[model samples]
Target: MNDPDRARPETPPGHRGVQYAGRALCWSLAGGMTTAAVDIVLAPGFHAWPVLWPLPWYLTCVSAVAWAVLRAREKAAALRLAADEDLVQGQDWERAA
Candidate 1:
């Protein structure tokens, strides 16, 4: 039943609901903007918190994404660790004396 014509190209999904990277970036940017806006609204001080309106939001988004990505990676690693059984393979577990 081998059919060379039946081969399918594969594409993987990205993290969290955002599949496309560009789309994720755009959304992240919007989230960052919202964060900054909220901050400005909550604590109004143009002179003291001048940079909070623009930079923090973007940085916040970056940090949030980075954290989520890192967390995902960590979770994957932990799962892999649980499945690791190299010691049980190609060997015998006789009592060492």
Candidate 2:
């Protein structure tokens, strides 16, 4: 039987990386907004200090998580490409034998 996945064209890693980056940015924005909302609700008055206090920490955490995810994706793509190359090489060897 023919495989469905083999018929489809593979997306470039850079395109996938862009998608992941966009998703990460969206999630980070949502988290920052939620944090701001909570700060606003809990604080007595509209104080810039309380609302803005978590900005640095939130940014740092988001950057770290995004970086890790992108790095992992890069590594996984590299491994997959290498595996594919190995398979092709093995098939060529088999044909030659």
Please tell me which predicted candidate would have the highest lDDT against the true structure: 2
| Pairs that collide, model 2 | none
Candidate with the greatest TM-score versus the true structure? 2
Worst ten in a row by lDDT for model 1: 8-17
Q: Residue 12, candidate 1: how far off, in angstroms?
A: 25
Relative to the true structure, candidate 2 reaches a TM of 0.49
Q: Write one digit per residue (lDDT tens) for candidate 1, span 1-97.
A: 2236545223222333333433556666786677677776777756856675666556557656865775576567555644443343323344332
Which ten contiguous residues of candidate 2 have the minimum total lDDT? 1-10
Off by over 4 Å in 1: 1-52, 85-97
The backbone clash count of each candidate, in order, is 0, 0
RMSD after CA superposition, every candidate: 10.8, 7.1
